[model samples]
Target: MVHETAAPASELVLEPFELSDDFYQRPHDAYDLLRARGAAHFVRFPDGGTGWLVTDYEAAKAVFLDPAVSKALKSPGAQAALGGDAGGAAMFGDMMLFYDPPEHTRLRALVNRAFSGRAVRELAPRITELADGLLAGLAEDAATEQDLLDRYAFPLPMLVICELLGVPNEDRDSFRAWSTTLVSNDETPEARGAAVSQFLGYIDGLIRAKQEAPADDLLSELISASEDGDRLSHRELISMVFLLLIAGFETTVNLISNAVAILLTDNGVRAALAADPGRMADFVEEALRFESPAGEGTFRYTTAPVTVGGIEIPAGQRVLVSMAAADRDPSRFDDPHRVDLDRADKNHLAFGYGVHRCVGAPLARMEGGVALTRLLAAYPDLVLATDTELSWRKSLIVRGLTALPVRLRP
Candidate 1:
């Protein structure tokens, strides 16, 4: 449904979009309106910069895979929107996220081994064991209410990521605070900047320790990669770790939380999976499509004028691929809002679309499958503590609940 034919960027008077209170409360409704209007909406982002928000699935997929769209977020407005950086590129360094082509290709290759299929396959037993341990503690309170995000969802992935990166368990508390603030859309730039500084500083010290005494861990491997024939600069090394730690667990945290919420709320989806444990993988995939954890993909800047879904967006403007909207676009899926675990199409853009698609998705799927299996096995009657509407966290990109209150037994 192209609302209008494409034209030059300067000749367009696009309808403005904003992140209103209604959007925060019922994002799907807002997305429905946007999709009905056109593929992309021209608007100012919360950070006070103008850009295009692509909610249509076809347009978003095209945007993600389009070479014309660069990963660089160099615009000063984008910087302010992403939470003003204290040291800019030098501080954040050459993050793989911001790189394109040869640079992105090279950096991703370096850390790819750490998350290889073989590596993750070997971690299966450990992951199961970790899930078992968490469930044991979670079961201690037989009938008491608990926030699944705090008790199960957050820790499971956080622990796995920390273990993979060789981060000390004692420092996880700090990571939780920093990560929450970092992903939050409500935090002030000053606060976000402080968190970034402290986070990188901690990583710096940890790297120093790993260098003095290398260990059998991903961080050690990354450090070695940096020192070896294919060298990684100090900034790149720190940024890689930062990217891994944040991307490694945060998305998974929301995935697990969102899935449980669905299982507790939707009887049909729950019953189908409960009847057949073999359907766990299918359930996880459907959950990703049904309730994408990462609301919007990482911001992108256009290098050249581009036309998407009947609208022309000029070069140098920011582009946001709204997975939250795209995943639910009615044109792409039949009854897009329903949780149809049996649906034939599982090709959702929840993780993302192209080279920049979340590299941790494999690990996330494996962990999510394990966590959901163990959770249901432990508490077959898991249900929300109250029948109230769950409060979603207000974040620029993070899609999760402020708290997922549930009881071990219904």
Candidate 2:
């Protein structure tokens, strides 16, 4: 598919990928057109910068695995696009996501033990218990129209991540607001800065508490890593905690909510899963492939001139994979748009590719499977209470519903 450098960056005429109406309403339609044009499209960003948007699976995988593509926020334009200041870009600092190989390797190694297979297995019972408690509350509520996102999807993951990080239940309301503000695109610069400041303050305070008296929690474990000679810096500690809270909670919230949204809308798939509980994992996989919580992978800067899908992207330009688009690329999967839970190959780039793949994916899958399975068992006739199309959160990266209204019973 390599077609040679599509002119030089300076000479190339940037076409307006005008997706105002279709972007929110039906993004995949827009993606289809973009993919047809080429593997990479020179589109305008929210910040008014033009960058390459890779929707082809092969090109995206290459971009992800290419060492020439950097994960740092060193570029001023990229920093602006990510809503970050000059000093610190998004997830900047000694965090794994912002670092390249050696640093990312070191940082990822420090916490890899915490999210190991053993750790996730141990967390299963607690997650199930939490889901049960949430379902009980939902059943008790007299309101016929219940918001699954608020009641079950949002809180379940939020509480689980908070508990893992040792964040108190009382502070969850504030945490929720901060996390939402941090992820959303609706906020102004001043608002985003304020939210970032408050979020940092809260995380710093929590970290200090964990450092003062370590407990039997993930935060305590992370804090104690310094004591064991791993030596996480203050910035790194805060960033790690911030990442876990946001990544662990926000992403899972969308996954759960999106899966339910699909089930309520697609009766055939719903009935198949309801009849066979064993297929819940497959259902979750298909959902992830279809409606990825993360629409685009994090920003990657081209360190050297690179050709993606045969188009040469000049160095110093920002680039990213459209996971939502790539997952549905016709070349990669047969009938990519269709929801098939029984597909033989369920492997998709929902979590991402290479080292930067979402670290919380294991926890997400476990929780998603448990949540869908038990929710269906508890309320067999669960259906959407509203006839309107579900509204989505206004975000450039995260794809999820603002709310999902459903009735637990007929």
Candidate 3:
């Protein structure tokens, strides 16, 4: 769903404007400007699609509640509405992120078992062990200064997901490379395509192997996962694996990296968390709000004219709910910019809300908590590396540092 605009409709109170690429690099100021103008602002993507960008917390929560405000790219109109956005719904294959109700509902049901509270709780010891190994590696590296994202943040979740999904240790590097390429805006279209091709091809081969020799892993379980006698098809299995494989770790790596960056820079937060390691849950949640890893929620399309934040968007228009903006809305969060571990409101849209809320959230939170606890306990003097400028990943939907250079010792 998309509506092209050269000029604003009189009713469109917040004027439509094109967003700059730099917004990703420095977004809080832009978010403050938009949120002040109104709850919903009509914005145009650089790629030529026009739609509403929801900055108000209430408006964003409303959008999540409305099932008619769609997520599927199955329609040509929907695809056109998100024109030229490289990592559009297609990159995700036919996973839950791109689907609404029935399909999403079915997929969520079939996959929920893998990320249930009990399942994640069961994964805690292994997660702790993974974090310890990575931290030990970081400590032993030649340089005292290291890119935490490379040394620990990326590896913790990547290793956990790979192990859970049954990816062989030898092939984990290939998956990491392919994943990095697919989510990267710097990668050329051909490169991204090939990465997607290679990722799916590998998954295809793995699925066959799992079929012949099913193991005690999520992939094997997904192959047999069924909802009301509806089992996963070969394609669905691949998409589900792709979703789990990438989303399972990519978002988390960002969360870990972002959280660590916060812990290093925000002394009050770091001290509180360090004093009482149990406060890490609060630390992680606040970090998600202050700097959402998934800066923007997945692109949503309007199936019918829908009113959000007092703006009525016509049918067949794409809508982007900025979880990054919504999380920091002053109305919902007092002193939103501050990194307070004891904010009265514990709710945040970091994992999103409603039906499509990330099914893997419990697991991500556990991983984030474990990673931070392990690192801080090991390196109480960790600080951002001298002369380092944190580089945010260029992807529009992803909001995390490409590298988090830090000194393990003061």
Candidate 4:
């Protein structure tokens, strides 16, 4: 194993183990040093597993598009390598994101119809209604600052997904709690296992209900499709529901929250956007590029030897493509650090590239666009709440603010 001495004061111990702290808390100075060293480097997992961290834009894209490098699930001993616990098993087995082609293609194709632009467009009216309702709740407390996340950002996406999936409105709280536990970084092995089991139980119940009496919801469609042998297996169906519940809500939640946070912090951008509602699309793209929710792409394992950024990755090794770093690559983007709403080359890897691109991109874009436009229009004087550090989520795979406190304009 290659052992480079840990950079001065680096949180990563330069051993074959996981980094000490979550990537979000790591000092910017450390990131700068690593960036300067190269876009990709070897990092040790806490379990003594070695993995590659790809930070450069070209290298990240290459790793993402290259079929030679398999997603972590495809790797032998992948379960043990990725914590070998119930959570790991659940992630690899049920999520299409972890699977490679053929299976990935089939699963993604089955769900793609439901998330198509036409289908998502049909929900725009409802999405707007939901956004307005959430905003209405915030309006009552306009005099005092509110946590945008709790008041608006979080619920909007969750509600939309639940409604789409035909999850009963009364069961929303239970769904939220179960989802929170499954995704929470604070949960222990036993706790996570229990949460996973409970979540699966909930999905099983929901699926059985859908099977008995179909509805016009997405889950109903998935159930029908699977039953007709046009889609997934029993296990796959449960996994897809779980995946949709998590992905359907989580990514959009961060996107909307992050966009508002950026706009509130930057007066010029906010004023510019507020002046023209038509610029909402471009502004959303900039937000995705500047502060992507998924900091890194899904993990992949080398099915065969592959060279990335001039470094040779041996077979059976894990690799991570840093979406955050790629979106900021100066080579592809001029003045990479600045948020340019008008930047013509916004072809960022934020949604990823190649076959595994995010299936919910259109819906995410619509939700974010509508949320920001309505937000800026309604609260022309929205400003950040004072004395809040804007705690970020701890997951290295997903990047987002935990809470965004803001004073809605009267």
Clashes of each: 0, 2, 5, 5
What lDDT does the true structure give each of the candidates? 0.82, 0.81, 0.81, 0.75
Per-residue lDDT of 1-410 in model 2, one digit per residue for the tens?
Answer: 11223566566535435445336556787788889878987776554445678899888888889998888665544454445553356445556777888878877877776665344458889998999888988886524988899999998998898888888988888988987887776777677778888988999999998888887788877766632467678899898888888888888899999999999999999989868889999999999999998888567877778898778887767787899989999999899988998788787999999998888888899999888887888888898999888898877678999999888887
Give me the candidate number with maximum lDDT: 1
Candidate 3 per-residue lDDT, tens place, 1-410, comes to 22334555664544566677776677777788888878877786544446778888999999999866888887543755656352445556487778777888888898885554343457889999988887887766534777888878887888899888888867878978998887776778799889988999999999999999988788888887776888888888888898889889989999999988888778899888768888888888999899998888567887788897666787777788999999999998999999998897979998999998888888888889888888888888888885655778777677989788888887
Candidate 2 is scored at a TM of 0.92
User: Which stretch of 10 consecutive residues in model 4 shows the poorest summed lDDT?
Assistant: 9-18
Give per-model CA RMSD: 3.8, 3.7, 3.3, 3.7
Rank order (by lDDT, best first): 1, 3, 2, 4
For candidate 1, lDDT tens digit of each residue in 258-354?
9999998899988998789899999999899888999885677777778999788876667889998898888889998888878899899989978
Candidate 4 per-residue lDDT over residues 84-134, each given as its tens digit: 432375444767877888878888878876555343558889998998888
Write down the TM-score of every candidate.
0.92, 0.92, 0.92, 0.90
Q: In model 3, which regions exceed 4 Å deviation?
A: 1-15, 46-49, 76-93, 117-121
Give the winner by TM-score: 1 or 4: 1
